[model samples]
Target: MNNIENIRPLISVIMPAYNAENYIEDAINSVLSQSYEEWELIIIDDCSSDKTLKIAEKLSNNDSRLKLIKNSKNIGVSETRNKAINLALGEWIAFLDSDDLWENAKLEKQIAHANKVGASFVFTGSSYINKEGKPFKGVFEVPESVDFNKLKRQNVIPCSSVLVRKECFETIRMERDNMHEDYAAWLRILKSGILAFGVNEPLLVYRLSVSSKSGNKFKTIGMNYRVFRSIEMNPVSSVYFAGVNLVNSLKKYNKILFKNKKIKRLRLTNPL
Candidate 1:
């Protein structure tokens, strides 16, 4: 795959940039430092009012593998990602938010895991970090594999830690809304009777921005509920799943918030 004839790239990284000047450099640098070389990073700037586009342009200029596109107006993140997806030219489609960072071996290992498990969709466990890039209390654990029923109950998949086949996107693309569109896409893919596997290790560092929707418990809960409803889930099942999601969300933070000496330090690693 590293040969020049395979210049099409093994993975297409989709990054949606929206007022992300504060952390865009770190995000781009993280990708530039990846161990895997066969990847094309397509960064879509959603008409940012800040220096996000400028920084992205500079990074794109430095690396031919990186490309930057701008939207005529300020579309939401979901739409911006879809725009990039449409432009992807790789067998594998990976996602990396403009603010989050990934381990150097994230792509190489995730692709190997996908081939080993024969899965079209794969995600990894993640460690949470604060605005200053310091470790935080929330850590998400992942199972080796999950079926539709298991995923319908709770979203164990992290968007930033996912590497999906491009065909999956053609089958069920992401929703255009801002409210848990990633979760919705996961559920839709699983509903097709496809199993999504987890790497069982934290290959991605999830950044927690208080201003983001996921940072707000109340807003996140509401968005989860709406996502369930959007999938045509019955009211009873939707409420049940929402309750389970709430419990899982609390558990994520509790793992770190109540950390003790017995717990190992949370860091990105290929535990497998």
Candidate 2:
């Protein structure tokens, strides 16, 4: 069953860019530095007024593995990603947002784990980074496996940390600009009884921006409720799960903040 071609399956990485000129180069560089070689990166510029397209163009010119496209109009992230998905060539699909960074061996480890466990959907644990690229205090660890029932309450899979089979998107695609598109899509996929495996190591580093909706806990909770609603969840149940999600999310952030405070105190006392 394994041949030279089968030995190294191609992976198409979908990256959607919108005014990400500042970090686009670093994001693309991370993909270029991956230990996995059989991968093609498709970067679609979402009509950014910034220099994102020019920078990606320069990189794509240097490497033939990159496929670059620019939208004629401003399409939202959900649609932008879907457009890139339509052009993907590999059976494997990986996502890396323009602003997020991946560890050098990210794809290598993820694919190795997938083959070992026969996992169709995979996500890695991640740590958060500030806009200036400083590491955060705590890591967001993921369990070995999560089922629909567990994921229904809260989504542990980060969009940039996901690696799924291309065929999985045949039915479901990210939508709903106002809500959490990726979360909704994951819920639908897992609802079909597909179990998602997690790589606990922090292979993905997510960038936290003050302007992003995810930075606002209250707004994200509302978005979580909307995600439940998109899946036809009852209002009462959605509210219940949303509340539970809020508490869990707050606990995680609080833990990170506490660790940060501890480190600051130690620095102050020891004069490090």
Task: Give the number of the best model, judged by TM-score.
Answer: 2
Q: What overall lDDT goes with each candidate model?
A: 0.80, 0.84
- Decoy 2 TM-score against native: 0.91
Taking all chains together, each candidate's TM-score versus the true structure is 0.88, 0.91
lDDT string for model 1 (1-272, tens) is: 54533333479999998898999999999899999888999999998999999999988998999989999998888888888999999999999988899999888788778766778899998877767787765567899998888887678888889999999988677775746888888888888989999998889998764332334555566777877887899887777787788777666556675763333333221111
Mark the 10 consecutive residues where model 1 has the least summed lDDT: 263-272
TM-score of 1: 0.88
Clashes of 1: 0
Clash count per candidate: 0, 0
Candidate 2's displacement at residue 237, Å, is: 1.2
